[model samples]
Target: MDHLIEFWPILKRLIKYAIPWKKKIILAFCLLISGATSEVLGPILISYFINNILSKHKFYFQSTLIIIAIFIILQILAVFFNYFQSIYFNKIAVRVINKLRNDVMNSAIKQPIYQFDSQPIGQIISKVTNDTEVIKELYDTVAPTLFRSITLIIIILFAMFTLEWHMAIIAIFIIPLVIVIMSIYQYYSTPLLRNVRYYLANINNKFNETINGMNVIQQFRQQNRFKKSIQNSSQLHYLARMRILKLDGFLLRPLLSLISALVLCSFIFSFSYFKNEVFEVGILYAFITYLGRLNEPLISITIQQSILQQAIVAGERIFSLIDSKKQEYGRNKKRFKTGKINIKNLSFSYSENQKNILNNINIDIPSKSFVAFVGHTGSGKSTLANLLMGYYPIKHGEIYLDDKPINSISHCVLRKNILIVQQDPIILADTFFSNIALGRKISEDEIWKILKIVNLFSLVKSMPKGLYSILGEEGNTLSVGQKQLLSIARILVKNPKILILDEATANIDSGTEKLIQKTLSFIKKNTTLIVIAHRLSTIVDADLIIVLDKGNIVEFGKHEKLLKIKGCYSKMYNFQLSKY
Candidate 1:
């Protein structure tokens, strides 16, 4: 019952995406009808050849040859129309799949930071890649096949009844019996197929995780353990596939038996009735031919039911992902030119029962001022940064930029003005210049200037292919410090007003850190810079340092002032000095 209910939404969405290609679908259906009619003519033509030309010794070679030629032409035309139909249908299916994939990706990316933190990367990838492919198969294979089967059954049965009433009655009875048997098999086996799909997804998820964490596995010398995990997942997938195969065998045996029985009985009954009649032997041959034709369409429907059921399951999963809530655009707020940020009584928690990650955190950052957040591990420093960027919602209170609630501002405006340079830079496997440009159309001069500002001009000039050098996967060939420099250059090219550095210098060497520090000092006067750092030495020269402990501010003042107080900030400073 639940599965049936789930299917409705998928059906609705399929129709929604398919609306644009309705004309093509209609043409495809027309082509299917023509093909079906051509098939129906084959048996009738055989009956004419057997009864009129061969049996009564009254033969017209010209007319017989013409009929044969016309039938052949119709068959050729049918194949041509089917080919065109497949082309249009596949094109539409690809478009719908692409649209669905894009929508799901956009929604997942826009989800709250907490959602991203809690979800596994592999599960999300499974939804976007494997699940979407299953939906595509539904359109490419199941939908058209099922529709064509219906057309063939209808046209064949109509022709059967016109040729002989008694045999037609037997067919009506036997066909319904086959349908009943198929329906029973479908009802009992759908749940198993659904399980097969889930297991397949689980296997894919496990494979993706193992491949992504291959480096960690090797570093920890846990290759045996990782291999065992993959082996277990593969065995489970094999068992699930075998279960489906078992059900298929069970259904096929009984279906074949039923079809064989029906054919034998029809042949015996037809021979008894026409044994002594003046009818041409060719007519009886054609009748037998038509009987064989009728059985094939019914067999096709029986066999394809399993595929249709699997498709329904796949469609349900895909539609569930598509129907998920989209991230709110927040377009109603008024725009402001100033860069003031106000957090008022803000509280946020990832879950309802958990303690707030940020509790009543109220602060104001004036326009064009450099502010830094200093905290220990698990002190909610990153949470605060995410909130300021509107990556997640605050459960209580609100955040404002220039006195306008941040929630009301459009995402486009926020993203255009605010940018974050993460600790681990995201390097696409692409050319050096393309990675730095990152989809923005910037002039060559602008690119060179940003590269120079980040002190990467010397490196680029020394390379054999300057800006065109290809970076290996995730920029693996680039040194850590070099990747950091490239990240800075990428950000500088964007020219954002609000710049965020979340421990951006943590992975680089001390010399690279000093260079980045000098660059930050140079850019601080122009941009609203918010730096989240654990190393007290990094933010010592900042205009203001806000110290956080357990989601609350323990101290907020100039670095020198906070040190003089000998509080949390002083203790952290003293610890760092001791380490040095």
Candidate 2:
């Protein structure tokens, strides 16, 4: 019982989302009560009119017409209130759901990359799509219907008790029994509903994963494997729904009907056993009417229990996400004057218990200097660049920008000055110019200028609509080289001071590599460039080359000097040249 009462607070919080529409709720409630009251009065008035005025002992024509008119009016009024109740309740449900969905999506957006890396994209999408829909059904289907049924039940009880306590005693006697049944069913079904929500999230995650990797599946001819995985997720969802079906199938309609029939029989037996108890005919008729209708609310509540529980479970997930700590942002707003980077005793890891990906690293990158980091796989080259980009927190290092600690700068300010170009770039589904500018208010000429810098002007000019040509998802219409150049053009348009190229040429052909190298050479004179390269030949003229081995810088100098040192850089340089 205590645990059941605990759900009240969660429910109240869900209701808080509806507070903005309090007026509509208030009016809807009033209308519901009015409709219920009018509905219950019908049986009472019919019994009264039949016994007092329409009886053979007292035939009154005008009064009969008046009573009939009043009955019709009450039924008509009930219809009116019922119609508007649905209208306002629907409006409230839609608007409240709209607000909640927007908040969940916005929260997901503000969350840090670690959150996304930890949780699957499909699960997050399920929260925004599936969970919100559950809450909507709660308010739209379960809530309003439950409210009206409960109101009518209350009115019927009051009418029965007012007529005769004897019959009312029987009605109230079955209440505790029904409560126990519903409570037991709810207790078992809540966790099942929770599991249903869980399985749904998994199914969505699997669907998203399969769709996103469809090309890989097809290429490897592993469609059967992916198909089975999807089927398994969907099967788990089906099994969970089956448990709910068992619960509702047993408790909702069949049990309520049985209980209502039992009550009706008990009333009939009580009246029959007390034959000389002087039960009034009119009051007896009313008792039968109330007894026949007593279980409607109970039935409705039992059936909608699954919906209520689903909403509650879904609410838990949705609110858990919304209430999660957002990505940390500093208050400092200082912008970088120069792109110089200084690291003192820097050591970093993706996680605390994990080994440091960059261990005790120290380096100085002067502004407007061309620098390159060359290392074999697991050598921490990309990790160092990411740390410089502020993607991860510095655990054992103090990084300085110009002269101040890097943490002293706000994220917005820091990101405004730095940009990272990776082997795989995000290409939004939009026009060429929009993809390049990306919310920057630069003109067409400026876009063309940056494109020319990246050597993509001719490519865009050859397109059907030039800058206005819509790119497919992931810019699929463009070759890998063209996509990469388009991404670089975007960076040039932003004109950030510090640029990190993290294996940007790893996937492109030699011709594209030369094209990108030319663009790099053109831009190296003005910006701080840190290139993490596998192709050592391209960076032979870098102002400085830092060679990392197992998270430590083993060699640092210009290419010719590093060759003389015959260290890690020398071996890596030799290996690449031999491959060529």
Candidate 3:
């Protein structure tokens, strides 16, 4: 019951997608009716043959053969119509699944960054893959089965009534009883199926996590631990499956028993009451055959109840994700051009109750000036950079670009003029030129110029295919320094107004660092540069230096001025000087 309630929203959404296929669905219905009518008439024709030809010894051989031929032709036509109906329904299922998957993926990509941080990657993957598959099964298998079962039941009832009204009434009575049993079964079985689906999702999530982190497990020599965890998850999944199967077994046996009992009572009553009438043995046989046909559709509907419930549970989960709050995008907002930045009373914290990660940070960067942020680990340097980049919302203050509040500007506008290169570079497995260009189309001359600026021109020239050379899997073939240089070269081609290098030189040797630093300095003439570094020597010639401690600006001045003060920056500078 709970699972059905949960899935109700998803079913409603699915029904919206079905609207486009109403014509095909109508055609399918017409085919189903035609097929059922032909099926019902088959037994009646056999009965006619037995009574008229064998029993009564009728000798109209030519007409009898024609009637038999017509019946065979009708059966063949019914098979063709059934096939068409199946094909049409399958098409509708595919259309619905495609639309649903697209909507879910779009919603996921638009979700706030914090949401991605909070949720497990494996669980998200399960939703996209496994949960969507359940929805597809609902449309492809359960929906058609349900519709066909209903059509069969209706046709069977109508045919039985035409043959013997009293017997039809008795059969109808059993239907109400069957309905009550189904209701009870659904009420009990829904929760069990819901548990089964939940456990199954967990199992999938665990499997994905294990596979993605296989390298980590091997590195730590924790294969046994992972194996044990997988075993435990598998056992839980098995138990959940068993619970559902047990419930199904209990419901199925009782339903089948009741159906059998109904058939027996109907037969006994027919034999007792109609024995005196000149009823043909063929008619009796046909009625029994119809009774046999009736049980199958009923059983099919009963079995589909479990699958329908599972789909509903899946739908609920999918819809919940789709309806989650997405990252805010400003509408009808004015766009801004790149210029100087101002941070005022900017006290920021990741969580509301947690300690502030940035405290009363007041700073100003003149247009095209190179500013450096220097601090020890856990000093909130990266957090400050994230704030400046608009990756995190300002908590207790405002950031202004060109003396206008950054919050007033749209993300698209901000991203257009700002770029950041991080410590760990993002390298896709693609041709060297494609990786450099990302998705943008740039001139070959521009690509070469950027590569030359980063001193990667010789390396590209040495490759057999030059810029067309393929980088396998996250550019695994390239050294760390080379990857970093490639990333810098990629960004240099874009030529943004504001450039941020967040620990960009941390992984490279001093020689490579010097080359990158020289290139960055050359570019700083026109672009405003913000360098976050632990190596004070790299930023010794910066226009200004800001020393951060526990999210607060403990000291802020030029290197010479801060050094003369002998504050936090002075101690760090002197320590580094002694080490060198």
Candidate 4:
């Protein structure tokens, strides 16, 4: 009862996914009933043959052949119905699980960016993939088997009562015993199944982290440590599975078989004790056959308890993800016309318990100017960029674009106008053209023109398929400079009003930096180009440079003016100059 109370709501939610295919589910169940009825009738026909025809010395060859033919036809019809019902159930399960996986994926994507910071990628993937697959087993295997077994048990019970009322009363007592067994199984197995799922998810997380960091692991010769970690996770999963197996071996089929043997002995003794000259052989045969059939379903029901528990656990995880708070966007449809940005009294912390990442930042960035922000590590450079992109909610700040509050801007307008190019650009495994256009309907001519401007036209032309060549996973075929150029090309096609280059030239060669500089000269004429500088040489020509220290703006001036002041920026620039 406690398990049912916990699982009822999840079952109710699962029904909604199945409701869309109600017609097919209903037809399949009807076929299942028909199949079970046919199975019940077959034993009765055999009993009639044994008592009325074979024993009485009245067997006509044609009559006996007719009865035999009818028996075969009944069995064949039962098989036919059962097969089609299973097919329908499998089809519905596929469609329902597909919809569920889509919902899980959509929910994961819609969660706030900060949520991803707290959650592992592998755990999220496990929810969408592994958990959904287990739920699929509920629909396809556990659900259908339980329904069919119950149907068959009910039909067999009715047939038993028709044979002998006293025996039927005895047979019905097995149901309560089976129920008790199932209840016990549920109590022991639910927690074990939940543990199995947790360890499995942990294994997936370890594998994902290892695969993504294989280079570092091998470089530092830490493969043995990672291997041991994954093995420990797998060992935990195996122990849980073995515990469930031992519980099942002790509680499920063996207990039912014991009851079956005792019941069989009671039925045989009842027949011997109640015997009379008029006792019919057909009735005795039918009762025993019905008894055997009854045990089959009882055994099946008990065996499926493990699968049902697993489904319940998987459903809980999937629903938890689906119920996570999604990032909400405003309804304002206004787009930025001029890229002027204003920040006033801005302060932010990643969490309430942590120190502020940005402390009372105030700045006025004019339209169509080249501005640079330079700071030491942990000096709130990336945090400010994240806030400007609206990746995190602003708790105590006012950011405005064109005199409108940043939060008032609709998601569509903000995404379309304010774009950032990170240090390591994301390159997909697709043709160069799709990577640049990114679902936009940019002309091939315009794309080629931009490639030439970025000095990548020669690289593309040299490829086997030119712009149509596949970039492979993460654009592994391309150099770092080439990938960065591709990121810029993506920005060029969008022509965003406010473009941020977040350390874009921090990892590239000198030649690529020069090309990027020339490209920035073109971009700054009509867009707000904000550069977060790592190498001071790139930002030396900026119209304005801001230096930050420990989340506070320390100085703001032209590069030469800052050098004369000999403050933080001057020391940092001179240090980098000394390195080269």
Error of 4 at 187 (Å): 2.1
Q: Candidate 3: misplaced stretches above 4 Å?
A: 1-4, 57-60, 276-280, 332-335, 576-580
Against the hidden reference, what TM-scores do the models get? 0.92, 0.94, 0.92, 0.97
Pairs clashing in candidate 2?
Answer: none
Best to worst by lDDT, what's the order? 4, 2, 3, 1
List where candidate 2 sits over 4 angstroms from the true fold. Answer: 1-6, 53-61, 275-278
In angstroms, how far off is 399's CA in candidate 2? 2.3
lDDT of 1 by residue, 1-580 (tens): 6655765666676668777788888987787777777777777777777667766777898988988998898789878877876776788789888988898887787665666576667667777887778777667666777677788777777876676666556666666677777867677767887777777777777777788789898899988997888788778878877887877787755665667577657756666777546334554565566656666666667777777677677766665555665556588545457667788998888778999887788898987788899888889888888887888766699998767787788887887767788888889999889999888899888888888888889988888998888899999978888888888787787566678888887777889988888778766766788899866788887778899999998899998899899999899889989997
Q: Return the number of clashes found in candidate 4.
A: 0
**What TM-score does model 4 achieve against the real structure?**
0.97
The local lDDT score (0 to 100) that residue 550 gets in candidate 1 is 94
Could you give me the TM-score of model 1 versus the true structure? 0.92
Residue 549 CA displacement from its true place in model 4, Å: 1.6
Ranking the candidates on TM-score from highest down gives 4, 2, 1, 3
